[model samples]
Target: MGRTDELFFEMIETYQRHAQTARNAKYQETHEMAEILLNMDITAMWCLTQRTPDTRSRLI
Candidate 1:
């Protein structure tokens, strides 16, 4: 598989783990860590697709 594909798959797993962490965490710091992972997920997905919010609507 391509490096991008690998990265994306890893990102997906990380996102899933973080989502679970967020669900279980009760402290503010833990919540912040989970939010950071969520942001990473978004950024990784954007990178895989080469996208930005200001760009024209993507076909995918």
Candidate 2:
């Protein structure tokens, strides 16, 4: 894959890790994040950092 594809997959992996962490911690938002990562397509996942309020704030 190209660099953009690599980065995109990396982002997905990072988000999946975070979701697992949140689920382990029993945070209320865990389900929401996990759902987004699990159910959304690549385009939607790419926009996730901007679409999710909490994630946007934390990431940016």
Per lDDT, the best of the predicted structures is 1
Tell me the whole-model lDDT of each prediction, alpha carbons only: 0.75, 0.62
Q: What is the lDDT of residue 42 in candidate 2?
A: 51
Off by over 4 Å in 1: 51-59
RMSD of 2: 10.7
**Pairs that collide, model 2:** none
What lDDT score goes with residue 33 in model 1?
Answer: 92
lDDT digits (tens) for residues 1-60 of candidate 2: 545455557877866776676577566677676657655545556585555565556545
Which stretches in model 2 have alpha-carbon errors above 4 Å?
26-60
lDDT of 1: 0.75
RMSD of each: 4.6, 10.7
lDDT of model 2 at position 5: 51
lDDT of 2 at 40: 56
**Highest-TM-score candidate:** 1
TM-score of predicted structure 1: 0.68
